[model samples]
Target: MRKLKKCLLVFISSLAIVLISYGVLFYFNFFQEFVTVKDNKVQWNNLPDDTFKSCYAPKLSFSSMPVTEISQTSINLLGNPVNNIKVLEKAQRYYIPLKSICTVLGFSLVKNNSEFILTKDNMNYILSNTDCIINGQSYSLRGNLIFYENKEYISISDIEYIFNLVADFDMNNKVISLLTPLSNSNKSENELTDGKVALIRLEDFSAESVLLSESGQMKFKIIGNYLNSQGIKYHIAWVPRYKSPSNNIDNDLLSNISIENVGFINTLDYLINHGGQVGLHGYSHQAGNNTSISGIELSHKYNSSEEATRSVLENAIDTASALNIPCTFFESPHYKATSKQKEVIKEYFQYLYEPNSILTFHKIQRENNNLFIPTPLGYVDNLDVSSIEKGLAHPTPGELASLFYHPYKELNFINFSKENFGVKVDYSSSSPLQQIVTSINRYNYRTIHVSDLKN
Candidate 1:
């Protein structure tokens, strides 16, 4: 009996030792494996010492690549870290299942390429090697085929394309719909004829934005030259009352301009002398955002103000009298006009630049018995190719290029004297406007300003 007890104790001690060793190995992730597969061959990179420092093993598994695969150029459904390739060359390019690759890299299938590149901010990524090279450094990857099911595959270009679609999200208030060409529409009976496009501007309410202001001037000059070169007529979005009190370059430009300049005394004189027009933007260009405005809404929406709320019209009329220009046209600041504001605005001005919220001219009469022509204006807040493309792709055709813009590097009386910086105001480079100009010139487009209408 003594001998038997000693043997049993020895066996128990051996079992305990084995269990302890297994536990320690598992804790250090010594069993963890990294996987990589290519051309029917599977390879793995050994896990780093830190991967399994705890008790849990990483969940590693694989899923079969179902669809047919093509050459290395073909995208694998499993996407990046592709471990397998199933060749099916005849499949339509769109049907290639490369969700993994597309989802990882944000690209689309507009064109074909051997390898796709991802560039965001300053980071650069190359998908072929399953390596993330950032700032000239490579980070080793641990997994093979980024396994999903019992089967493993690579992502590569296929996944990159899908991600491209996701990143190109469209979020904006603008909508495009086809309408009859201007030639088919009835002309406006007023001084400013209907069907004639107009160029309107928002007075940069902030005085601190001088860079933006100079930028705006450069934009204005560019647009003006384009219109003039094309022989297209246009009108300026001027607020005489908003002019700087100083006799600076801005004032001189305003005083010498031939089109409608928004203001009080000088505007009235210009209108009287040049057979020009006067429009009401707002008193002090108003103040507010989506809500909180005390004035007649220039947009089609109704306002809650007594003068549509703030008696904005009363203030506007008073300002006009003070400045000497009769307010005949109404435009919303930032294009945020309300219904009540519209009704009240009509009491002061004879016409209003149509708001985009109204889909068609027919829709305008349904909203208000008055005439609201659809005069679309391009709203540019920044210098970009996309913005310029929008202007050209959808110009008013034969009407004015009523482009609305704001340029202010800083508000106040200074900064306009500074050079336009390195930013090319003219279309000497690959500017969209230049592209449009080249296109229109090639096609022979005749441009005209709104004030040039014969009505």
Candidate 2:
């Protein structure tokens, strides 16, 4: 009996030691495995020691200001100067009169006690002091609500934020230039006479790769010059950084748009000057060792957290802002992202260039304040025009026919012929892209900027 008791105690001690070791290993994540993609193969490895310690810091922050009085200011609504519109200056921030601005925007503003209700079409905004409800969604105003001289006032930034309009405030001149789709004073009514519109997007333009080469520069100029001559405004899906997946060296894989890439920047500037708008197209367009342009960046497979998503977006936005390029819209790499990731995207951009789904395309879908512009015609793959023509065949009045094409493909299509090897490619009538645009024009579809379709 004594020997059996001693043996039993030893066994209990051994079992406790094993159990405690297992718990400690799990607590330290020794058993946890993480995936590292290499050469298109998935490799599982133990979590790194500093994995938990590293976290992405937020790149954006907002500062609140107190209300203060200052000088009167004038306003410009789509280049037309407005007179007698009293603007309030609060803590160096300009606040436009809600009633007066609403009147200019053709929106009806009604006051009930301390609250003001602004309505236009399907949009509704209820402003009560520092709180605002837009389209049934509530938001706290960064600039405090002020009542000056028997009229309610909202900050210039707030006006842009709430109404989805672009507001540029010139502090020195005390002039606020407001641009909205609502204002059609600058547009000819006959442009979209049939109510058919089309948006052209050039995809995957980055600082690195062939786009910076001499041939690449010519191709870009060809496309830009052609679009300008056709009176067509388009969007460029710009990737701020290019990461080549096949390259193992860190320095070789990553390329940024900086002063070093002067030639590329100049080409971009030329495009922008000729009615080309830049749209954010992911930071690297790849996660880990996956491919760029083809790989998914903001899906559950990679950026699972909102913090990670915001960090990626901020990086892209900051990169473009550094080069003085404006990113008014966002297009996810390969148009792949989770719903949660898209929600975070909405916090930054007012427009998203994508479709409702793979099957549903042809209309602009609105989510809260962000607009999801669809690409109904898809892309021209290997110079195939069948898909594009099929999309152009059917048109509903007021419907949008949007599509994207890679400028690099133009090089292949235009230069593949031996006869045209050394000759300059004229994009006006020779290229398939020009043909697609001509088809869109033939269909009575007026080419318009993405912002013009906000209404």
* Highest lDDT model number: 2
lDDT of 2 by residue, 279-391 (tens): 88988888888767776788788887988998789887656644446667888887787888887777777678886453335556655556677786778887887778777
Candidate 2 global Cα RMSD: 18.7
Model 1, range 152-211, lDDT digits (tens) per residue?
343321222212110000012111111111110112222211222233333332212221
Native-to-model Cα distance after best TM-score fit, residue 107 in candidate 2, in Å: 47
Candidate 1 regions with alpha-carbon error over 4 angstroms = 1-232, 239-278, 288-303, 308-310, 325-328, 356-358, 361-370, 373-377, 385-403, 407-455
For every candidate in turn, the CA RMSD to the true structure comes to: 35.0, 18.7
Q: Model 2 off-target regions past 4 Å?
A: 1-194, 248-260, 357-360, 396-399, 413-425
lDDT of 2 at 227: 72
